[model samples]
Target: MSLRDRVISTSVESSADPVELLSLKNPVHFLALGFGSGLAPKAPGTFGTLAALPLVWLLIQPGLWFYLCLTLIACLAGAWICGHAARDMGVHDHAAIVWDEVAGMLLTMFAVPLNWSTLLVGFVLFRLLDILKPWPISYLDKHVHGGVGIMADDILAGILACVGMHLLLEMGWLT
Candidate 1:
């Protein structure tokens, strides 16, 4: 096979132990791996999102503009982070590269009231939207490629979750 073909087909061998990822020596891999939350044997996405919660709570305390600028930075930089990490792992969008979820959750909680109720509701909504991959989110997940592709679906899911969450609050449905 050609070098290009070989590179394109590169992916994590099934026999490799998932926990070995925790030994990643690279910084980008560490961040893209969601600080090891993606190392979880199951539901690593959920764990990655959960790991982002405390971070959001702390960061959002400053105000919306600060939170937004930071989230944008994270999202933009995360594309690179995830891309390099995936390449290192020899996989495309490995289950472990969940920094996308961090950016997604940040977007989901953006401008929303920082209360337990809103946080809980938004968390559920984000996970549901991400898992379900409704509409354009699903389209992006299927059609897009590379690190941008990995992050795009979660970003769309985050936008949807943000819209759903804000509606819930505005309508006084969840408070």
Candidate 2:
């Protein structure tokens, strides 16, 4: 049955071991769960973003166009990846479904030099915007629904963080 056709379950909300039901072997789940990083008991988003760092480092190696292209591809595919996992879990935007975080991290690092300083700053900014949910970010988070909804706020957060990172770099603050 389609997700809309069935009643959403409270199991995700009530169960203590929601991760157990999901398999890492499933490609969609693997991606949606941030390559198993989302399985973290607490602060799954943080863990998920952390998991993206190495990937981001490697992604940036191919130059700006390559990084941008891959990031775009990831963003496009994220909706289906996250949505499918959410459907299987009978939840919308489950905590363990952190593909959004991965995409957000990629966005956060956009056009920025990858280094310890930039990585640390980008990580903080993305997490803060994501956690705080200020203004339109909060609006998108609340108003949007489904996988796109799940991704929208983080996307904006990443963009904002990217802007912030650029500002810092331009001002010689991040260097």
Candidate 3:
């Protein structure tokens, strides 16, 4: 059965499988899948962010302004794509839809110049803040709804990570 059929049947209910979302025909679904990175059974969000590294690296190659534009596009696009995909899936913030993570990671690395060590620390910090959802991040995650809500928390986490990473760099802690 097609993904549409599967979604509509309602008779043969099944669990939300990340891989199963790939069968969907919607362009938004494909986008929200992070080009299939979200199919990972474990840590799909991490996998989606990992898939974003090369693109983020390329975006930064042109310098910060260009990177910001690209990251901005991702954030805007993520809200639309993730929102549509979640609605289609009949689930809120389904695990299979991780374009939010890609956008989040891109935002996380925005302030820092691309480097192996910098990327490593940023990754850890982004994941930590995203998972921990400190202060305003947690507040948004709880209060917000829909795609904006899904993406907002991560965006805040990225901002926090970028700030933290920048502070650490300025402190001569990591280069």
Candidate 4:
């Protein structure tokens, strides 16, 4: 692996170890549960979002309102978890805390069809917008701090992803 990749991997691995991670209080543990997905050698954000898919799928089944509620809760909790974890690690937006991605992905899937094609498209679109940080997402990433810092950009990306997915659905392109 490349030097940068190796370093990020090491950081993520170290941070995600439950033994090491659980020693922390509330938010830290949640952040660690996201695993090292947030610290991928490349496309960490995309990896993080992908890592959340299984869990998101599980949570989304109840209904759109439930899913959206869960998304809001996750977003609020993610801020705490990410902030605490980042503080413990003595870093700003450490690569290991990916709960933000979890929340974002859930938001992206909100009100969208639960089919494989839609899920796949949502995942891809969310990751793209997240990585690109278009418009308000980019602005939020720069301007926000703490838990908001960790969660805001991804939330905005999720919104964009949702819009894209909705459009695709309307166009019958997701089938």
Give the top-scoring candidate (TM-score): 2
Kindly provide the TM-score of model 3 when superposed on the true structure, using C-alpha atoms.
Answer: 0.88
List TM-scores for all candidates, in order. Answer: 0.88, 0.92, 0.88, 0.79
**Candidate 3 residue-wise lDDT, 17-97, digit = tens:** 535544546677777888788888899888888888888888988788999998999998788888877766667788878
Better of 1 and 4 by TM-score: 1
Q: Please give the ranking of all candidate structures by TM-score, highest first, separated by commas.
A: 2, 1, 3, 4
Residues 72-113 of candidate 2 have per-residue lDDT tens digits of 988889988887887777778889989999999999999998
Question: Clashing residue pairs, candidate 1?
Answer: none
lDDT, each prediction: 0.84, 0.89, 0.82, 0.75
Q: lDDT (0-100) at residue 99 of candidate 4?
A: 79
Off by over 4 Å in 4: 1-27, 30-36, 39-42
**Candidate 1 — worst ten consecutive residues by lDDT sum?**
3-12
Superior candidate under TM-score, 1 versus 2: 2
Model 1 residue 42 distance off true place after TM-score fit, in angstroms = 1.0
- lDDT for model 1 comes to 0.84
What's the lDDT for residue 131 in model 1?
93
How does model 2 fare in lDDT? 0.89
In angstroms, how far off is 17's CA in candidate 2?
Answer: 3.8
